[model samples]
Target: MDGDNPRTPLLSIVQESYLPKTVSIALKCILVGLNIASIAIGVIFMNECPGQYLIPYYLIISGVACLLFLCMTCLPCVDEEQVTSVTLANLCAQGVLLLFLFAFFIAGNVWIYSLYHGPWNDPSSPEYCARVLYLYAFWIITLCHLCFLVLLCTYLCLLLGLYILKRSIFGSRSS
Candidate 1:
């Protein structure tokens, strides 16, 4: 209660709140190992066959994102700065993965629809217009994915900049 007593409970609270999950080292490592493996699979398939049957890709990528989101969300939220950085990083990464998934399914639907009917849908004729529509949907999806990645990169960079700021503040204060 007294100003003369510099050591206060609030200091401990702040540190505990602001510090990232420095605890749970072994469990964190395990979670991280699993995440790496999951991300590896997602990226491998995503890069290799962007146009193939995307069911597996969607499941894997979403699974990884959900796992990571769960883990981060579960962590103690004492360190506001660290939490903010992690959240921003998560959003950027998750947004790209999810948007890619969204675009894939939507475009696929459009492509299939177009290929069946071409410019005109006729019950009697083979729908060649379907292919044309598919191309349109696919390219549009592709463009959306590109833009998503760009935005993700920007947010990630901002998080990294925040990390640097936190480091400098600590370094100067300590010295």
Candidate 2:
């Protein structure tokens, strides 16, 4: 088998069944949808608080990445080499982005939570309600990011297994 075809020997059955492609497409769609939803929620509850811009900024980046992923997967002429390279690069970039998002969300959550114990402690106050909404949005965004991270990790593991198998079979021959 040619080195260009990363899925040939390792996951021939899966490739034939198109399972990887289907999962990739589904995950990308979910991510894009979640990003859009998060952006909408953020916009609807827009506030002038410091660091409030992060929510929409992250959503936009993730949404664009998901769109790019969809486009790459939809291209009919993508070779296995191109697929492998592009997927690896995309996963790496997304992993980093997700890490940043996770930290940002955690920080935002803490800040919002602190507001609850501060002057916005009154349940009837607008500031209190806004904090609650921000907290909810951050929680949902964190969960979405976590889901994407799990999907990315799983895909990476599968790719790594295939790479290791290819290396073992080829015995030191560079792809």
Candidate 3:
């Protein structure tokens, strides 16, 4: 009786593969939608959010992480046959994209909204300076946003690398 459903940890592990194909494709679609929305919002709300809330930049990072996780878990590591080979380089690229999104688009912009009064002000006092600093940070923030943009490109590059890797290792073409 007990033998009928014997516990097999390894079997369960293999059964619970990392990513489902439907989920991966759906996530990729979501990412495309998000990027388009951000671009559109940035265009529409140019005054209020400028370039900040256009598309929820963190989504890009999240998208990348999701993709990488899908890749790692959906397909087993070609070389190691062990789980540890997934590189930090991939994770970090995704993380940097997320951090930039939160800091520049979410936190920094909100700070501006909170402190913002009008277009004109006496540029003096520490508080004003802080606001100015944040204002200055807008460029840095923009740079960070751009960094995420590039990070997005980098994520794609990694995928391309993965394709090459898969081909070389398994003689398999990415479907």
Candidate 4:
């Protein structure tokens, strides 16, 4: 009777998602939509100012990278409990891509923000980038950085709290 359900352990392990599967799928879909929007904005940015191309390229690269990241993570064979060669390769690929993207984002920031002080409405001027594209890209980059900071802080706090709890529980037991 105990051997009747071979998938019991697999099902239990797979069901341990922090968010429900439906919610996870929904979030992924939403992210995909956002990525598409970003790419479209990037195209507009390119069309607006051909000289300052870094931000537009940055937007397109980051958006496509995110889309690929989402697709890679959603593969059916990506079981956390069962670490296969494919999973290892996927993880390594993701890490390399993220590192490259992070560096690219920093470069984009330098290029975009350095020119943040100039012509808002003149295509005749050399420094003129479309106001809408520049502002949107600026806010998006700023918000991404802000979000990363928030998540990092939250993770650190959680880790510290868990460490303190473990120490207290163990100290009380020893006493």
The lDDT per prediction is: 0.51, 0.57, 0.49, 0.77
lDDT per residue as tens, model 4, 50-147: 44767787788889998998887776535669743334466678788889878888898887787677664478878777877788778888888898
Which ranges of candidate 1 are over 4 A from the true structure? 1-131
Error of 1 at 157 (Å): 0.5
lDDT of 2 by residue, 1-175 (tens): 5555655454443234356767876776776686677556556655533434454444444455555544544544366666433344554555676676557656655555555455453555544444544565557656757978999999999999999998898976755
Summing lDDT over every window of 10 consecutive residues in candidate 3, give the lowest-scoring window.
50-59
Candidate 1 lDDT by residue in tens digits, 51-142: 33342354355446646655654544455466322344554665676676566556554543344334333334443222322343345446
Query: Which residue pairs clash within candidate 2?
Result: none
Give the range where candidate 1 is weakest over 10 consecutive residues by summed lDDT: 128-137
Against the true structure, candidate 3 has what lDDT? 0.49
Which of the two candidates, 2 or 4, achieves a greater lDDT against the reference?
4
How displaced is residue 108 in candidate 2, in Å? 3.2
TM-score of each: 0.31, 0.45, 0.32, 0.75
Evaluation by lDDT, superior candidate among 1 and 4: 4
For model 3, name the residue pairs that clash. Answer: 38-54, 38-55
Local error of candidate 2 at 119, Å?
9.4
Candidates 1 and 2, the one with greater TM-score = 2
Residue 7 of candidate 1: its Cα lDDT? 54
